[model samples]
Target: MNDEVAQQVVPRTRYHALFVVAILTGSFLLFLVQPMVARMALPRLGGAPAVWNSAMLVYQALLLGGYAYAHWLGRVPVRMQAGIHLAVLAVAAMWLPIGLTAMELPADAEPAFWVPWLFGASIGPLFFAISAQAPLLQRWYSVASGGRDPYALYAASNVGSFGGLIAYPLLVEPGLALRGQSLLWTIGYALVFLLVAGCATLLPRRVGGEPHVAHHSPAPGAGRVLHWVLLAFVPSGLMLATTTFLTTDIVAMPMLWVLPLGLYLLSFSFAFREGEALPAALTRIAPVLLLMFGSVLIAGDQQLAYVNALIGLLLLFLVAVALHSCMYRLRPAPDRLTGFYLAMSVGGALGGVFSGLIAPIVFDWTYEYPLLILAAGMLMPQAFLFDPIARLWRGSAQLLRIKTLAATLAIAVPLYLGLFNPGGLLGPMHEQVAFVGIAAIGLFSVGRRIPYLVALAGGLFLFGGYRAIETSLSGDRTRSYFGVYTVTDMPRERRLAHGTTLHGIQLKGARSRLPTTYYVPGSGVGQAMLAAPQLYGPAARIGVVGLGTGTLACYARPGQHWRFYEIDPAMVDLSRDSGKFSFLRQCAPQAEIIVGDARLRLAQTLPASLDLLALDAFSSDAVPMHLMTTEAFTTYARVLAPDGLLLVHISNRFLALSPVVAAAAARGGWHAARLVYTPSAPEKRDEAAISDWIALSRDPATLARLTGGQWQPLTPQRSFTPWTDDYASVVPVMRALNPSLADD
Candidate 1:
């Protein structure tokens, strides 16, 4: 009997190991392909960030589908379940040697809708099959192992997810081109299939111990199922919300989005790993950190963009660990794993709706981020000791429902008056008021529901509401597809901005392609435009893509033909019609401004007619990924005459765009040179100053002519790497620049 028990344990142990390996490999492949395929399509689709958001939505939806399918499969017998999944795997393989289909992007179509649909159709089936493996296979492992604690495999699953995400930007993308990435992924898929087949051979012949019987059903009751859904939803949605808030010029960078997601996935591993305690102490303090960090992280006016981002991510993970641990404590038995995961999928999808879809339309800003943070604070477990009043009240049965509403009201009065009510006695001391409010709320929330509400209110007021009200009342904000552009009206006519590389200022109203702020009368763009009459004649064919208050329109001359390719209609209206600035109507009233994506509009214009094409659309944080690629430059080259100039506004807060410009220029066989425009203090009129501009041209004469006497000959930095469609790394580029030089 002892020998038989040992033999039985051996096969089960080996099969458990195999199951872990298979799910991990599958998850790794699943996440790896997301960024890989997206990077491959950058050149083709024109790197609009909306493309990325759309792609992510497709992924979330498909993930939900996969979970739903897994839950449904639990009704079948063991052999039937294994056979059906195997058949599904074989059928999905038809998309093998997988790559995007030959169907090209429509020249005039919007990428926001099309990119998701196209990519979804191409890889949806394959991804769905692989995604389903985690939940379904884990359940099978449980049955095969005779009710063993197999849930630890979930942590292994997320480890693969983190590995896949980290490896792509670090190893896979930098190492392989698009074609190579696709082929490698296909190979990984094949290996997963074979491994899964191997594991399938180990699945028990019976539901429990009866050979050839059907799978066992879950325990009766809806309350049990509801717990699974809530546990899954909060973490999934919060993960995405963190991505949106952090990645936007808030802490804007390409790979920065991965950090929040990577950490979120890793939390699952920590919570689910076998023998791990999910640490009582860490979870105990998670709410305190979430409240403290979550409040100040959102509210302060300090330019600690990177630091704020770090705090935000840490708070998210800590809160996630706490919430996930709670779920782990309440996790149903192994037979209900698939159902549990399905509930999680439903929550994940709802989170996407809140952050990606509903938030954009509902809030004028990304308020959803802070709203979700408050939600997390509410839903996440609080320590009984931390809520000492509650603990005390619970100790006395009579006080359970009626403890301390009077004390709460008295404390809340001073807090609300001091923090939220503007111009209260504590008016001059805002930060002090906010700090007091946070502390008061934290203590008050101890024994009752009212305290949680107070904490949430205090959090919102301290973190977001205060700043938003100030920004709104100031009337110094701009919203474009790229990001929010705010030009604050400051003392001495100097405007401070938070997003975008360049801020063009005209004396409230000025005209003549003359420059202001970054493009001062003495700057390179100013000098180039001033010389347009001599360089390309009064009939100069000029083109400007980003029309920021139409400041460049002031540089235009009579009879000079000018064209503007603007994507956002809101910006066009603000620049041309809004009384805020009159640069366009005064100097270039007759200039044609086309609305749509600049690249698409540029493609429609007559070739070789433009004398100078100034790619100066740095209005906000987003770097319209479509505008600075080899293909984009080639299109510009085609539109300009032989010696025509291409002046790119390469100035960026979060990115060093010179390399991308240089790479595109190189690919197009054009000579490019950068002009680092640093305005002297004496030149600083009451305008937003500091800007960097780079000029690229195919003709030596145009390059020479633009740089002639106005700016120094720029030596092309050899350290700069060329950005390609399939692979573009920004870490080196960002590291070379300083973040503090902006005219704040």
Candidate 2:
């Protein structure tokens, strides 16, 4: 009898392992292709950070479709479903070695629409086919394993997803080019086909068989499905918002993009596993973390930006795990598994749409980050840390009302002082005092839902949210598909900032015409601009790629033909027409401004039209990878005269980019010199920031002329590959060699 039971269990265990491997492989490929295809599209679409978000939306939408397909396939027999899925996998293989299609973006294309269209065209069929594998395979596992619970297999799926996301930047990207990455993914897809087929063979022989588990439970109601969706929504949206916040406001590191998403996928593993201790404990503590960390996240602490980024990530992970665990607790029997996942996919797609697509357009700042944090607070499971607190809440209706009132009043005192009377009555530490009071109230309100939500909302409003609201009300903040920009008027200067990076600042009075920030006379770009006439004679044609406050226009001499290429139309309005910065209107009023991507516009210009080409385009603090590629430099070379100086603003807070420029210069047969410009104390007081610029030219004499004094020879890394349209990764250049250089 014991041997009979052992023999039965052995086959079931083997079947389980086969299904797990198949789902894991499919999920890994599904996530691996996301970043791969996005990287492939960087050159054609431009590297605005929003491009990643748009790609995410396309993936999420496809995931929804895939889940829905799996749900609909349930009406068919198990054998038919397996056969159809295998056929779909074979059909999707035709798009193997995935890449962008031959579709060219229109000159006046809108990125919001164009990006999704391009990505969907490139990888839609393949992603759709593989996305359905997780749910479909789980269903097959239940049938094959004699009505065993299948939801635990989801943990394996998400573990594979996390691995794939982490591997792209750390392994595949640095080691392989685009073509190689595509081939590797194709091989993985082929492996998935075989593993899936092996799992299919384990299915029951009866064509119309249903799992015995299906007879034990009824179908879920409409409200239950909606509950699953709400549980899924907050975490999905919060993940994207956290990614944007970390990359935009915190340190912009090379692999920072994967951290939030990797954590999000890992949360599913923690949430869905058979073990309950970790998920339950995390859910219990989630409310307190939300109130404490969510408040501090919105407060914008640049001094502790890295610490804050970690906290934000921790907060996101906890929230996602808690909410996902709620979905797990509410999960129906094995019969409704596909429908459950379909609802989750719907919520995830809606969340991505709201945060990735809608928030950037509707709000000036990252309002979605706070809003989603609040939503997480509302959705996440809450339980008292102690039995006494639970008893106090469960005593009586009247007692509960009194306790809630006291909690609200306790939270309100600090909120009121922090909002209207900061430092007046509570002294200099008033903000700290308010934080403690709100945190205390939030702690006690846990497990009491309504009061805890009130505390969370209060925490959000007190910590930097009011300031964001003020900025929005004043019309000083502008949102574009690229990023958020804010203009501030100081005592003696007006400043322009893209996200947290200062773009340009203009002093009032006589110094208004003088260049400031990175374009000061002592900077490398400044030296190149000052020597424009001497290099190419009086009628030098100058083309500046980025038109930030048009500060470089001050270097334009009377006969110099200056044309500015700016991507954002809102930026043109601010620097040129909005009467904010007077650099363009005062200095180069007649300088033509062309509104479009600099690379695409530069590609259309006649050959040898410009004597000096300055490349300074930035999306927030990130240098668009496309502009730094060898192909982009080829276009710059085509548009510039033989002796033309190509000035690249390599000033960055997180990345050491001189090596990249040096590699490109070596490949293109150009002499390059780098200038590390540190201004004098007096210059610092006058808004002159430290800047790094690299000057390159095919003519050695021209580069020599530009780098005469402070410039030094480029130190090219022998192992660092030159970034080309075919492949580029920031891993080699992210040494943080000059962390003090302010963004240009």
lDDT of 1: 0.72
Candidate 2 structure quality by residue, lDDT tens digits, 1-744: 133323333277679788888999899998899888888887777665467777877898899899999988887778778899999999988887799999977876776799889988889999999999999999888877766789999999999999899888878988899999999999999999999899888876662234332344688899999989988888989998898788766666656768998999999999999989999988888888888889888887889988999999999999999999999999998878998999999888888888788988898898899999988888887888788877777867888899888888788888998777743887776777788888888898898888898888888888888888999999998887666789998888888877776778998998889898888899999888999889999999999998888899999899999999988887898888887778889989999999877887888899999999999986556768889988999999999999999999887766777878888988888889888889887666548888888999999988887787788888567877899987888776665533432232
Q: List where candidate 2 sits over 4 angstroms from the true fold.
A: 1-10, 207-216, 736-744
**Cα lDDT, all candidates:** 0.72, 0.85
Q: lDDT tens digits, residues 1-744, model 1?
A: 144433443366588679989999999999998887777666666555567777878888888889888888877776788899999999999988777777867787677688877787789889899999899889878766766777789888999999999998778766776678888999999999998898888865544434322435556378866766666667777777777666554566656778888988888887776654544666777777776677676653347877888887888788778777777777777777887787777877777766676665555555666777777776777755455555565646456535545545555565566556665666677556756665665655643546655665666675567777677667666554355556655333424243423355555322223457766756667777888999898799999887777878878888899999876676676678665556777778898988777877788788997999888765454566657667778899999999999888866666767667766776688886666666776764545366677787889877887685535444444755565555566555554344532331
Error of 2 at 449 (Å): 1.3
Q: 23 in model 1: Cα distance from truth in Å?
A: 1.0
- lDDT of model 2 at position 177: 90
Predicted structure with the largest lDDT when compared to the true one: 2
Ten-residue segment with the worst summed lDDT in candidate 1?
A: 492-501
TM-score of each: 0.90, 0.95
